[model samples]
Target chain A: MIELQHVSFERQGRPILVDVDFEIDRGEFAFLVGPTGSGKSTILRLVIFDVRPTHGVVFVGEYDSQSIRESDIPHLRRRVGVVFQDFKLLRDRTVYENVALALEVTGAKRSGVKRKTLSILSAVDLVHKRDVYPDTLSGGERQRVAIARALVNDPFVLLADEPTANLDPETTDQVMKIFAEVNARGTAVIMATHDLRLVERYGRRILRLDDGRIREDMGLVKQV
Target chain B: MGLLLAFREAFRGFWRTGMVGLISIATIGASLLVLGIFGQVVAGGYALIDRLQERVEVDIYLRDNVHRRRALVLARDIEALPGIAEVNYIDQKAAAQEFQDMFGAGMLRALSQNPLPESLRVRMTPGSDLPQRLQAVSDVANSNKDVESVDVGETWVGALERFVQVITGIGLLLGSVLCLACGFAVSNTAKLMVLAQREAIEIMRLVGATGSTVKLTFLVGGAMQGCAGGFLASMGQSYASDWWTSRVPDLALDPTIDLNFWLVVLGTVLGVVGSWASLNRVLSAVSIK
Candidate 1:
């Protein structure tokens, strides 16, 4: 579960997020839709405690922004997965190595890392490209590798920041379907994107953000 | 698992930054080789000084008419002196025999009579004030009625002492400067390696890896480079020592295994420290996009 209580974030005298408040329970899929500079990524960053709230508190599971120790940030991140638009994969590592890194960071056993990494790669349909480096893969395949890495840890919440920004329409659809499948398997998903087409197609709970404020909260509705 | 990961990441980094890693190793090796050679020179100088100190003795020559019994009594008196460790009376006959042994029997045969004087060889106990003690013993011997002259080798011994002091001072100053340069070389290597892996490091931090985990990776890499450099330096030192010994047989220039092992240890420590310092400076600037 994630909650932001009247959070206000400012950077260099410019307000990025103002009085923003929201909550989403476990196993729910929500789209945080907003235009450019609407502070969607800042909210995701806050949930992971990458940055503290300027004026309010954020609660991610049992870690509160007000009291969380610096040493506890890594533990907090292990339970929350994040996917970036650029795919953020190590250029030197193979697909399997990249995915296994998620488990390796947690000091997982060798056999367990292999098993979990292979299983997650299978789930993301990237098992055949296990040994290939990220530089050689197509845009969609790289994104799938990134998705597998995020989900390999079985995080409770998956925060995606414009994960499909660089992919073609067909590839974006494939990526979205993966997110949908992951959500169906009981992980809460909060994807932030400026694309309206995705908002109309998925038709899950929508939280519209504008000018550092949540403009509207559209409840779950039927898919278009 | 954590240590294994650190090693794996360290090797991976080495492989990733191929030439840069080699450069780091070579830099450390070169620095250590220079240091090792300097150490050998200093060690050799001290060894030579020790051998010379052992040979130091004062000789009190007696007048030609002094009786052998009187020479023995003078030896006993010199033995009772404050700093004298041992005193040996050499009569005219024994002194002549020594002269024959040193300059050959033909030189002694050329003389009409045994002209070498009866003498007492006095050795002093080892102490910081060796030159002064030798001077005091010489003065006491000169006051004796039967004594003709005393030779303490004062001028040469004083020169040797000054040489020891000069070498020690120079060794400390040059050693400090060399060590600082070696540290700087290692620190620059670590900085370059960190810069090369900037993206990977940022990604690792973002993926929930602990700060220690990420740091351990780079630290291990730096240590490996340093250790390899040390090994190389030790090999070079051994080779140089052998060449020096072969060319100059009188001087012993062998480097012990213990010295080599210490060199490697020094290299490892420098590697770890250099990596830690560079990481402190660079890690802060790396932020998640």
Candidate 2:
């Protein structure tokens, strides 16, 4: 579960998030819809304890922004998977190595890392491209690899910031299906995007952010 | 698993930064090579000084009226002194014979009577303070009524001691400055290597990688580069020393195996320290929180 209570973030005295408040229970998929510079990324950053709120507190599982030590940030990250718009994969490594790295950083056993990485790669339908480098992959494939790397650790929540922003409509649908499958298996997902059409198509709960404030929160819509 | 991952990442980084890695290693190697050469020069200079010190002996010439028995007693008394290692009584006949051997029998045949005085050839201990201790021994020998004069080679021995002191002082000061410069060079090169991989490091931190794990990766990489530099420097020093000795046999530099081993170890330490310093500055600037 994750919660941000009356959180406000400022950079160089400029307000990024103005007294924002939100809570998401476990196993839920929600869309954080906002245009560029609307503080969607900052919200996710706060959840991962990458940056502390200028005022108020954020709670992700047992970690509190106000109380968590600097050394415990890595442990908090292991439980919260993240995917970026640019698909931040190490270009020098193969797809398999990129995914395995998530587990390796956690000091996972070799056997567990290999087995889990292969399983995640298979889930994302990227097992066949496991040995290829990211530079050679299609935009959709690169995003899928990033997703697999994020999910390989079986994190309770996945934070995706415009994960399909660079993909074509067809590739976007394919990547959305992967998120749907992951959520179906009981992992909460908070996906940030500026695309309103994509939010309507998914028919999921929406938290529309505008100019550093949460303008509206539409409860979950039943799929047609 | 942590250690293995560190090693793997370190080697991967070392390979990934190809040209930068090579430059770092080369910088360290060149610095160490200069240091190694200087070390050998100092070692050789000390060796030569030691050889010169070994030949230092006091010649106490006895008067013409002094009997052989009395000269033998003087030799026994000088041998009992603190710094004296050995004292041999060279009687007038033996001194005459030695002079003949040096100038040939013809020079001694021209002399109607032997004029060489009986002397006590006194040798000091190896580590006894030169010039000062030699002066003390001369004073003690001169006090004997039968002795006419004492020759302790005071001027040359004092000059030799001063030379050793000057060389040692200069060697230490220059060696320290050179070592600090080399450390700075290696550290800056390592900083560049780390900066080149800055994005990768941020991603690692963004993931679940602990600070220590990330540091270990760089530390291991730096140490490997340093070790390679050390090996190169050792080889370079040996070859250069051999070439030098071939041209100038008097300055033969024979650095022991122990010295080479320590050079390699010093290289490794420098690499670790450089990496640590770079990591501290870069890691602080690029904080995740």
Candidate 3:
């Protein structure tokens, strides 16, 4: 579960996210629809505890952003998966290694890393591409690897930031289907995106952001 | 397994950095060699000074016209003295033998008479080389009727020891400053190599890796550099010392001085501390989100 209560973030002299409040419960998929600079990424950052709220509290499960110690931030991160439009995959590593890195960070044993990484890669339809490096993979494949990496540790919540921005339409749909399946499997998903069609096609719960304010918290007619 | 991964990562880093890693190791080894040699020279100087100090003792010359029986009795008294550790009596014939040994048979054959005097070479107690003790021992020998004069050289070894202390202090200070400077320069260059590559450390921290876990990789890398550099430097030191010893046979050097182990220890400290400094500076500024 993630909550942002009356959170306001300012960078330099400009306001980013002003007096924002929202909550997405466990096993729910929420789309964060917003224009550029509407603070979608900042919300994800707050969830990841990269930056504390200037005036309000952001909560990720039991961790309070304002009160979490630096030493405990890594533990908090272990329970959440984050994906980016850029893929954020280590280019030199093979798909399996990149995914295994997720498990490795948490001090997982070798056998567990192998098993979990392979299982997650298979779930994302990337099992065949396990031995290939990210630079050699297609955009969609790279994005899938990122997703597999994010999911390898079985994070309770997933935060995706425009994961399909640089992806082709067909790949975008494939990526969306992966998210849909992940959400169906009981992992909460909060995706920030500029794609309105995804919001319409997926028809899940949507939070529309305009000028740092949440304009709409609309629930879809049929949830995936 | 965690340690294995850390070491693998470290080796991967070393390989990825290419010439930077080689240059770092080379520079580290060169500086360590200098430090090792400096240590050896300082230690050698101290040993030489100690040997010379140990040789300092009082010498009592017997009256030239005095009876040999009285001289033998005075020698026994000097031996019984509290501070007198050993007494070597030089009778007229033994004194002439020493002169002959020094001057050679041909040179001594030119002399009309034996010029060497009967004397007692008095070595004081092992640690009783204090000026007061030396003077007291000399005074006891001087008061003897059979003794003409006693020579203690006014405890000049004390001044030599004080001088050696100053030199040792300077050597330590200079060595420390030089080692620190070299370590800083090399670590900075190594830090650049680390940052020049993809920021793997940031990624490592992003995915739930603890700070110590992330640093473990870098620490292992630095330690490897240190050990390798230490080995190279020790080899260089051995070669240089050997070359110098061959050229300057008069200079006494301790072949058994095991500075290799110490060099490795020093190299380890330099590597770990340098990498720690660089990693802390870089890692602290990065946001782990």
Candidate 4:
């Protein structure tokens, strides 16, 4: 479970997220919809412990995010899967190595990591492109590789930042389907997106942000 | 696992920055070689000084027309002194023969009579009090009217001792300064190489990698450069020493100094420390978010 209580963030003397509060329970799928500069990425970063809140407390499961020691950050990170909009993948590495890196950094044994990495790659339908480098992969394949990397560690909660931003409609649907399957399998999913149509089709809880404030928190209707 | 990843990353980095790696190793090797050679010279100089100091003894020349029995009695007394280890009485005839052997066979024969005095050569204990004990011996010998002069290589020994002290002081100062410079240079070179591959570092950190893991990779790379450089430098120094020894023929140099082992240790330690220094600086600048 993730909890954010009156969380605020600042960047270089400018306020970014102003007293924001949100929560996602275990196995609950939710949407974080906001404009380009509405602090959606900041929220995800706070959850992942990459950035600290300026004036609020954060709790991911049982650990206090802001006050936890630096040594414990890696353990906290392992419990959450994060997908960046740019799909940050190592250009020189093959798709398999890029995904395997996530496991390797955590001190996973080689054989076990290889087995788990291959399984995750298969799940994202990227097993066929496992040997291909990021430069040669298409945009959809790159995003899928990023998703597979995130899921490789079997994190309890998945946080995606604009996962389908550059994809075509069909590929966007496919990526969403992957998210839907992951959420259906009992892993809580919090995705930040600008696509209203996809939210309507997925029909889950939606939290909308505007100018560093949460404008809407509502359940979705059936997309008939 | 951490070590393997570090190795893999370091190896990749070394290969990627091909010429830079080679240049770093070459520079490190040359610096270590210079250091190793200086160490050998300083040690050799110290050994030479030790040998000369050990050979120094007090020489008591007997006065002319003094009875040999009275001089023998004085030599016995000198030998019985606390610091004196042994005393050999060189008779006038033996002294003349020694002079002839040293200068040439005819040099002593040219003198109509044996002018050299019978003397007592007194060897001292290994670590006997030098100036005070020498003064004591001189005092004891001077009291006897039969003794004419006491030679302890006065001015020459004093100058040689002072020179040894000066050389040792300068060597320590120079060695410290060179070591500091080597550490700084190696760190800066590693920093530049890290700057080139910073993006890879960021990606690794972004995905739950610890700072130590990243640092270890750079440290390993630096260490490898150090060890390789040290070995090469040691070989070069060994060859140079060997060639010099061959040409000079009589110059004493210990070939079993284990220079290679020492060079490798120095290179490896410097490499690890330098890489750690540079990596810490670079890691501090990165933001995971």
Off by over 4 Å in 3: A221-224, B51-58, B65-85, B104-115, B124-140, B143-145, B151-167, B255-257
Error in Å for residue B232 of model 4: 3.9
Of 2 and 3, the candidate ranking higher by TM-score: 2
CA deviation > 4 Å runs, candidate 1: B63-86, B110-112, B123-147, B254-257
Clashing pairs in 2: none
lDDT of model 4 at residue B20? 77
State which candidate has the highest TM-score: 2
- Candidate 2 Cα deviation (angstroms), residue A169: 2.4
Q: For residues B9-40, what per-residue lDDT tens digits would candidate 2 score against the true structure?
A: 88877777778788878888888888887777
Superior candidate under lDDT, 2 versus 3: 2
lDDT by residue for model 4 (B166-256), tens: 7667767876776666666668667866876677787777678887888888889888878888888889878877786799755444533
TM-score of chain A of each: 0.98, 0.98, 0.97, 0.96
For every model in order, the fraction of real contacts preserved is 0.54, 0.77, 0.65, 0.62
* Candidate 2 chain B weakest ten by summed lDDT: B251-260
What's the number of clashes in each of the models?
A: 0, 0, 0, 0
DockQ of 1: 0.68
Report the error of model 3 at residue B107, Å.
7.1
Show the lowest summed lDDT stretch of 10 residues, model 3 chain B: B124-133
Q: Tell me the lDDT of model 2 at A20.
A: 91
> Against the true structure, what is each candidate's TM-score?
0.91, 0.93, 0.89, 0.88
Evaluated on chain B only, candidate 1 has a TM-score of 0.85
Tens digits of per-residue lDDT, candidate 4, A16-131, equal: 88888888899988999988999999898888787889898998988776678888877777878888889988887899999999999889999999999999999999899899
Predicted model with the maximum DockQ:
2
